[model samples]
Target chain A: MTVTASVSTVSSPECGAGRPDGEYILIPAFNEAGKIGEVIAGLSACGYTRVVVVDDGSRDDTAGRARRAGAVVLRHPINCGVGAATATGLAYLSNVGAVAAATFDADGQHDPRDLAAVFAPIYDDGADVVIGSRMLNPEGMPRVRRIAQRLASWSTFLLFGQWSTDSQSGLKAFSRRAIGTIQLKTNRYEVCSEIIAEIRRRKLVMREVPVRAIYTAYSLSKGQGFTVGLKTLARLFIDRILHW
Target chain B: MHPIQWIMLVFAAIAEIAVVAGFRRGKIAAKGIFFWTVLWLLVGLVAVWPDSTYIFARWAGITRGADLVLYLGFLAVFFLLFRHTLRMEKIERDLAALVRVLALRDAPEQTNQPRADGDK
Candidate 1:
């Protein structure tokens, strides 16, 4: 891909040449002190120096670890769920004039190597929103998670008439325009479907990129169980009715 | 009408009148107050003539008028509870958002602070 000169002007020269202007990698963390530092370091090594970590009320030293690893840490006084953390990070990025932002999971499940591919479309201004879809390859993804994600994707399609292979993927990249226009209200996992709804509602161009999710015992344990999935479904239904 | 039924009817009538009077003095919307007053008066009439419920229930394919009222009441209560839960969720989300803003705004940049439990 040919690097656009305008895009080159906005990226940090120290990280990688031609990185999007005001681009930042956002990680919303909760009690992942053990993994937060590695997540930040991985991004930095990828030539993406602009990193922001929203420590979602972790009782551990997640905030301190992230800061030490060269990340701008934003702390939430209490756990506000992943959705709220992502929103806080996005709000901060927008305030700081970020041209694009990518949200990465802090559970050590995501690969930092995919950051460049995820942000490529946004950097080239080819898409307004890019979602990382594990279903594209489904390698290393647990069977339960794969099933849950498919069900969630089907439900999201039913609600928003837009479908993605992985609607529940924790990784997504948003252009500056998408960040400024898409306002998220749901503060939990339901916010993932809400984003799809917003993309449909605002008619924003969305692209799904094939990405690998390395689901280990720790990451698998942190996923939404059956009960949480039910609650999420209920909330989404209520929100849909209210919007109607 | 039976004596007991008459007493119940009179009590319901009085209660409706009081409610209407309170609505007039309260800040409730005029349209809502009027609707409630009319509903209460109708309810009073039904209470006085319990037999009417049987007729209505039969028309609605229910076994008894009392059963119809019970089912409707349950439905109303469930609807109200659902709405209340939604409202409460909204308030909680708003509070979280406020707290998040405050936290971010007051984020500590001091990296030299000693870890109370290092590598524990």
Candidate 2:
């Protein structure tokens, strides 16, 4: 895909009213009705209007809640995975002529204030991909979750030969070229690592920035527990072995 | 021949014939029928010559012929189970993709809830 110079050449719009210069916020959610509305409201208050939510086959009224929140909802009829949902969101953003895209978790863990910091590099043409790293400022992060996130970072380094402080962070900002070109194959949580692998393979310029995480009991429950984290790691390793 | 040996031979012959008939009737694939027929013929051979299993077991470093056959059978069963599980996961993934595509295509153009952000 030939990325025209027009992609990064577009300037970021001042946060006043309408959709800002093709910068979109994508939320990949599954059964996150309880928090999705509040998250969207926060982003809307911050003047980020181009929000797209991929409802990942939730049994609940997640799509309804997201639509109510004024987000363009893309439904997945069955629960695919976070990876698939994110891919779907990105595909839609690219289709809608977005110059840059930012992915935020739907579980209310991400601070909406940090969306600008994550997407700034892409908006300014300073980086192709900006990863919001929790490791940089892990205040209020649980110890067990911190350890698992570290292990994920280390594993990503070992597998993809590129190391970042946090590899599984849900908050990521992508340039139009990155969002349009990166091919995602995995349909599960392993897509987090796959994104890193894609960045490495394509030799895209990547930067990591500090971002605050809101770790309430509710958000903590949505995170990968010990067993789930282990399973995710095993699946990622198997995917690497399979060259997927 | 011993009564048990005769019984084994008759059963194996029946099984082999049944597999061939299944293939002819299009109830089983050619490869599956061939595998079952060979398995049944092997059973008949073992029954006719009980010493053959002992020779095979010795080659495999197994002291008991029955133990060796049991181990091999367990291995085959486990492998088949593993394949079945993997196939099931693939099907589930495919089904999820289908559902996602349908949802994206068929969902209402206008949401029931009012547009919260207000951008067209």
TM-scores for every candidate against the unseen true structure: 0.79, 0.82
Q: lDDT by residue for model 1 over A92-168, one digit each (tens)? A: 77677677889889988888777777787776656778888888768777787889899999998898777777889
lDDT of each: 0.78, 0.79
Give candidates' CA RMSD values in order. Answer: 6.7, 5.3
How do the residues A1-244 of candidate 2 rate in per-residue lDDT, one tens digit apiece? Answer: 2211112212223344454567788899999988899999988887777678889989999999888888888888778888888877777666666788899999989887777777777756568888888888888888988989999999988987777788999999999888888877678887888888888888787877788899998988886778878888887776676575
Model 2 chain B poorest ten-residue lDDT run: B107-116
Interface Cα RMSD in Å, per prediction: 7.5, 4.8
Native-vs-model 1 lDDT? 0.78
User: For model 2, what is the C-alpha lDDT against the true structure?
Assistant: 0.79
